[model samples]
Target: MKFGNDRNSSRFRLPPSTAYRQAMRYDDKTLVVVGGSSGLGLATARAFTAGGGRVVIGGRSVERLEQAREVLGDAARTAVIDTGDTASVTRFFEAIEPIDYLFTPAASYTIAPFDHPDEAALASPFDGKFWGQVRCVRAAAPKLARDGAVVLMSGAASARPPKGAALYAAANGAVEAFGRGLAVDLAPVRVNVIAPGTIDGDLWRRRPAQVRAAAFAGQAAGSLVGRPGSEDEIAQAVLFLLTNGFTTGATLFADGGYSLR
Candidate 1:
């Protein structure tokens, strides 16, 4: 969506930031991304591989996993995992050893107003995103390295719920809280949350063009920055959480200040 008729939105591009420019050296490290087949997770996986880290990418789709492996090449290993299924999570971790970092962003759910009749729709966010991450962490605990970290995916909805997104917002809030509590529980193995704003990425691209445009415009108008964020930007933020030893029990809002407004 255009910022406005009078203003040139293209001029509002993000300035060069040190976060994306800084060198990340993860030569011998390994990253486990539960949703690494596409979008933000895929971006992070690519960045980690570029930093010389080995990645184990898990997703529900075998075809997508194979596609991701093609993009990541020998630096990555692919597996099928459905976070909503406990046994699937267990098997995904069992196949990989000594994980240096973990990021879970795979979730499938609906977001609608409270008046929606389908009970399953209301519960899907928690089932897919909140509890899904919980199951993965529980299963990965044994394989997680003491020096490693866990980064969970959350959304700006947790802070500011737009109309018809109350449950979605609540689920995201739960994930943020889960990250804090899990951080303490995991101890030396850090746990953090990346609550990103509306990103113009693969996820949104699947939606109708008109709907996608409207969502992007609305998100841009709400944020301090007058633009939607990129998958790569969120990817860099996740990497920061993964590599930073001092940070834990924290939720980093990479939402262009959407919550503030």
Candidate 2:
């Protein structure tokens, strides 16, 4: 089902009053989603667009960006950008004027034991995923409109700290810290972080089936709900944060109790 633009139609229609309220809630708002070509980012873009916001999706791959644009249809805009590069980040932000919402799911990580971690393997993530968010937030702050909100992505690794995932854990930890600090600094702009657990999606599609299954099993074992999360679930959390004006400096976990166990 589609929302916002008339190019697509929704399967379910709301009562006239409810539909009017929903439209008034998000009509004409502009959302910028970095790394929005796939996975959680793409899901978030769809949620915002469905709520009547004009969404702009940014990513490093032109092909993926075009694919995303196709999926989002006319209500969405696309931009090619590498968030790691300061110049590219600058240009992307400059091109958009007075954005009402910004969401970044841009990150990279290396899984390795701390003792023998490859310095080279860490460089890209350290620069792109960790500092990439920093640079994007820095560039986006001035352009964000009053009452605007920014949601950054972190992960369960930041809190879980499993073996052979030292680098990923650290990077996520840094991201959480960045969100906390930025929330204070970007007052009235409503900055927050979403720390999602083992969500069942295509992010690990390249891995072997057995590997994926075992990972899912492990997540089920740890989660109180005994299951992995879905991309749609995480996307809903993003929507909650974006719409809830009172929420800021918060780390909303969509982990299905993975962090508890």
Candidate 3:
């Protein structure tokens, strides 16, 4: 069930009025999405392209990016970027044109107990999720359109830290703060954060079956909605942040009311 990707596909057709609204929502706009090869990033890229927005997807995996290019069709382009490396991120942005919007979900780090014996493991979240996003935004700042918007990915764990996720919580909290401060410092270039809850997506699907089941069950029990979120749901929230002119420095918790619990 490909949605909004194949324009002629009959399985997921939009109504006339809805189609009209989507036709040119992002016409002449170019969006750069780091970590867009899979999961939430890929879903957002597809949605943007469907709205007539040109998307430049950046990721560390060549094979995954190629796969995403197929899903996005001609409306999107792919680039290689290692968010953990400042030089790779700089080069990735340097090769691209001015961006009308930017959304970064790329991070490579481990989440562990605060009392974990390995010091590096304890510091991994800040190095990857926190600093990695900061680097990408810094590189893309000069190339961003004055009216453009930026959406940084956070997680519901920031607000409601569950067992064994204290470090992860702290990292997400930092991202939210950074989004607020960056919104002010970047002025006219809207900056926002999206803190999503547990999602039934690629990340979870790849885990061991028992582990995945246990995690999902716990997540369902913890959230107000009693279920995990979908990638498309989070993508919609991201689009709203990018297009809403009056929204900036706001943290949208698209967590199925998880944070409220």
Model 1 is weakest, by summed lDDT over 10 consecutive residues, at: 2-11
Per-residue lDDT of model 3, residues 1-261, tens digit only: 644467677866667965654654788999999999999999999889888899999999899999999999999999999988999999999999999999999988888999999989988999989999999999999999999999999998899888888998999999999999999999999999999988999888988999889878978888788998999989988999999999999999998775444
Model 1, range 89-187, lDDT digits (tens) per residue? 888888888999999999988886888999999988989899999999999998889999999999988988888999999999999999999999989
- Give residue 183's error in model 3 in angstroms: 0.5
* Model 2 lDDT per residue over 5-63, tens place: 55334645545864654554467899899989998999888877777779999999999
lDDT on C-alpha atoms for all candidate structures: 0.92, 0.83, 0.92
Error of model 1, residue 31, in angstroms: 0.1
Better of 1 and 2 by TM-score: 1
User: How far in Å is the alpha carbon of 170 misplaced in model 2?
Assistant: 1.4
Worst lDDT window (10 residues) for model 3?
Answer: 17-26
Rank the candidate models, highest TM-score first: 1, 3, 2
In the order shown, the candidates' Cα RMSDs to the true structure are 7.9, 7.9, 7.6
Ten residues in a row with the worst lDDT in model 2? 5-14
Predicted structure with the largest TM-score when compared to the true one? 1
